[model samples]
Target: MIGIDMKLETLVNNGPAVIFLCRAETGWPVETVTANIVRFGYSPEDFISGGLRYADIIYPADLEIAVSKFSAYVEKDYRGKDPDCKVEYGEYKGEAGGHKRNAKGNLGKGRGGYDSFTQQYRFLNKSGNVLWVEAEIKVLEEEEGKACLFQVTVFDISRWKHTEKTMPSALDTENELKRIINSGHVIVFLWRAEPGWPVDFVSENISELGYTPEDFTSGSIFYTDIIHPDDLDNVRAEVSKNTEGGRDYFSKEYRILAKSGEVRYVDERTLIRRNEKGEITCYQGILLDITQRKKAEVAQRLNASRLEALVKLDQMAGASLKEITDFAREEAVRLTGSKLGYLAFMDAYESTLVMHSWSDSAMEECSIEDKQFIYPVKSMGLWGEAVRQRKPIITNDYPAPNLLKKGYPKNHVHLIRHLNIPVFDGKRIVAVAGVGNKEENYDESDVRQLTLLMQGMWQLIQRKQLEEALRTYSGELSRANEELRSVNMMKTEFVEEMRFPERAEYGEIMDYETLYAIDSQQQKAVNTFIHYSEKLRRLVDSLLYQSLEKAGKIDYSFEGMQLKDVLSDAFLNNVFLIGEKALEVEKEVPASLPEIRGDREKLTALFTALVDHAIKFTPQGGKLALEVKEGADNVHIVIADSGKGISKELIPYLFDRLYQVNDSVTRRYQGLESGLYICKNIVDAHKGEIWFESEEGLGNLMHVKLPK
Candidate 1:
């Protein structure tokens, strides 16, 4: 509805681009106009194809707000509600024009990108480069064909992007890294896996590992070579995944051997890596000495095996539900350095107690509804309040201030006690333990000591959480893996479905494209399976390495990720190629994708495959868009192109890993067909997915999903 070609002409050199706009909901004409903008070369194809659809461009997080805001306004019809309810959003740049040039009008990248189109928005045009934008939106109405029509105008603010054109001075970033390591007794070294992660750096403190930096950096210092042979595989896997995905916000913890040949515990803190082409590399993690912390944990653990002060403590283990209560009743007199104690098991709703363990030596247990022992929040008693707050509480004074309704049994007053700690299983507070009644009732020191014991008590909790996370991620990964496997198995089945030679009546085998699809499907499926399997392996390894790292057992390199290099090559190769379109390449192409600890070769192959397609489908003057966005653990590269859209019948085939679009050269334009196939493989290898949305005549949007 609003003219944009002139504005796109003025914004090319400011920086990479991101487009935004509000469009009329009128019908096919709007769609046609959008397609024309893309075809005529005003915006990148991917930009137009993906976001132009109604409400599709909204980020996952923004959708609800965008929807709610719009719905509320439409209901009011701008009469009774907030006018500020105007949709505020950025626009996807218009397609570049057929014969466009740089701001200088030099024979350069396609027509330029867009300029500001509204107070809150502008259109993003990358020419032929990658750019991204984040914005809000509003709606407008106007006359169309003698009737009122609704439209949305998008705003693009891509020029503000902080593009990383160069790496930070290595000395500075590295020195800060060294300062952190030297201040602690932690040993650090990079780990490199042949046919796997390769470590290229280590701290001088590695000498504590019985090896100097030189020895560590050399073949003689190979981490895998020194890793406790039993943990080598796990460590390798975890580190690989971490390195591949951006590890900034993630934590890694594990154990390793010191140069003195002694087993040492460690903790590692992560620092982020920033790279050119805007990929957030894996964390440049540094190790800290956690040996003392480890020893303390060990000592605490050993104490659990036997408690000397309480004669019957050893018998507490494996006690039946009834026996457990019986033990608590009998042993409560001495177990907590107190003459009296009690334990209460709360019901599932935490609304009431189902069971109680009280001191036999004590005169009596409080009633369930008594203000002293129940209605956790309503009771001011130390025990009830602690359970309510879900934290430990301490009181050294008998009937302290608000304790127990300010009343106490004449004899019970002697049991000036303290402490109520919630025993949690997952998020639920299943039980509460109260320690009390002694000649020398609990005080600050006792409270402190007991809280330390909570750690061991919570070990089971950590184990449960770990088990759950593993189960969830594993199940999701398994399901996805199974689906891919099914596709592969189906490929074998496809051959059987074929009417071979004279055996069938489909006569001459339907079409070459059909047969080609069958053949390509096999390769695509198999390759895709292998690719994703490799990624799964990497993710598992990365997680492990992170575990080992956070545990202070390893210091792995963060630079081998090579995301920039891979994405760049892939974006240019065929994924974004316009073939012989003589389509001008605009937008800035940073030297490459940022390098990190991922499988470089694999990522590179992925980009190559996608770029090949971008080029193939795009006609002369058609635009292809590749946008790269980074996070703490992964890099997201989106490759969008303007070309004959994918038909409804082709989506399944598209993901059919090895299958290309060209089943028959005469019938399909997807050339070197394996571009999508290869892209899928590469993405899967990197623990990512490949997906797109398109229609006949409309352009296509191909998303290359990869972990950082």
Candidate 2:
């Protein structure tokens, strides 16, 4: 068997025929061919290397006729009942009234059960010499019966063609004309000019679209039935307008539904067939599938849009969180072909969602009366599934009944489709981004695009947060440095004052009266030193507490404590400062005040800070009042001082870290500006509210409300 195979191979290789295999496409791109093809003045490399196609070497004039005949034969043979059918074409007239010699042979099934046909056509060699060849072509089809490749065996027939010329008979000419009308890649249709465009005939190749020609010819399906509903009206209008304008032909592009329920884009070129009276009797048209081309165009546009969106996002450096989120949501809606979108950030614990932004369209279309910014994850609907699942959730059919759906709020924007993706920072789902109401189903492509875009936005968000935090830290550090310099200056002044006493002691004691006067002056200096030392101690303590609080290292021991006792302790601690300032103090405490849950040390510190602030800011003889009373559910404390009150603009920043109203070097107040800020923090830690009401020069009134 091996020897026989070798001999057969040798015979074929030395034969005067060139065998070629090609893709069943428009140009019939060559894949492989026998070495003998070089005898035609062309190397096998030319076709195999994709430099030239089989159609490129076909004689220009005969190319169209050859393709038509070949297509007709393949189509007919493929639809035949016999699996091993043989086709024999009789004599046919050449193009443009030319005559050609008859070339005939049996076209049988090839090695793989594929059908083959024999035909003769003119070809051009490398030197442009015209040669006649008998080409036997075989059609290779996939398992699903779609033709994909062609095998061709060409025999030199120039000698026979030059010796004989034969004219086809009338029957042969009629049959050949019919075959020409029914061939080629396009699906040809003949329709009577009626309401539904009733089909009179359709080419057999229409089966490639998963439909039979007989289905239309038998009136089982109308051309209108196949056209997509969205595109049908436009197609009809185009055809009508052209016909009314007396145009012989017109072209249109529209979508059609194949038998498998897939949407296909087709380019239709229609000719208005008319009778002798020029009245439109029927329409002849061909539909060429352009689905792949349309898809490519859509993909290109989508990619360009995504790139543009990313560029815009990159340009949003230092933008506010709202601005960034709004832009990202809008772009997500546009890119996904959606009508609405939203972006929400998850809390650190991932227990709640804080809505960052909603697309402009969604905000306008939604009519819900209550728009809550923060939502507990457990309270959300299907949109929150991304957070719960820690992955992307897609609902192409939003209206379909789903167990996860908790329904929308009243008058909310209607959802047709929805896609939600969780943005992750490591293992944590930091945010949930979503878009909805796309015209088409949301696929993985949309998921991928949205996920990537949101990830980029998240990175920018993190960067902005870090920048804000750094700015705050820098401001705090600058204030701290200033406070340190002030303390150092005070220390130098204290040292200079001590030298006066030292020099006084060096002088001799003159008399009893003089000695007593000196002793009195020294005592005064000691009191002044004590006052400054206390002020310095308070400054250091405030700085230390602030540092610990910022580091999250402050520990509190919560316990039940008497509100009156806490206030008393705070007053006794600052009694000296009150006496130094000579401010009149008043206290109004209800004996029936209830006990409150708080940290005793922190509570004492909170009150002391407030009292100290009042004393330092109050003028001599100013009144200081402290009052504690019981409310329905809280203990209300009021600390009012008849000092120069805070200005309206400065009151807003009273609790901000390191903020000082009188930040000038020559200001009368002496101490770190963190007393009020620390007081606010301590109150907050005990689950209480603190605020102030004051006007310039009207004395400030501070209010503290703590739950009892």
Per-candidate TM-scores read 0.27, 0.45
Best by lDDT: 2
Top TM-score model: 2
Q: What stretches of model 2 exceed 4 Å from their correct place? A: 1-187, 202-249, 257-262, 493-502, 505-708
Worst 10 residues of 1 by lDDT: 663-672
Q: What is the lDDT of every predicted structure here?
A: 0.49, 0.76
Candidate 1 regions with alpha-carbon error over 4 angstroms: 1-334, 339-366, 369-392, 403-415, 421-434, 468-539, 556-708
Model 2 Cα shift for residue 605 (angstroms): 38
Model 1 C-alpha lDDT per residue in residues 1-708, reported as the tens digit of each score:
134754444432222222334343422113212322342145434444553453443444545655554443332222232334233323233322222324543222321212111222222342543333433322222232111223333323343333222324442577775775654476554433344333567777766666677764555555555555566687666755654543323345567666655666666555445465435443355576677787677556545632542334333444344554555444433435666666665643455653364666553544333333444445434456776677777776655566355355443435465666776543455566667764344545454444434333333333333344455556656766676677667666776776576667664556768667766765655555554454444334434543654597742222455566555565555422244466644333345455545566656655665665556567778787767766566666666667887666556556431122332211221211244544554455456767877777877776655564
Cα deviation of 337 in candidate 2 (Å)? 0.9
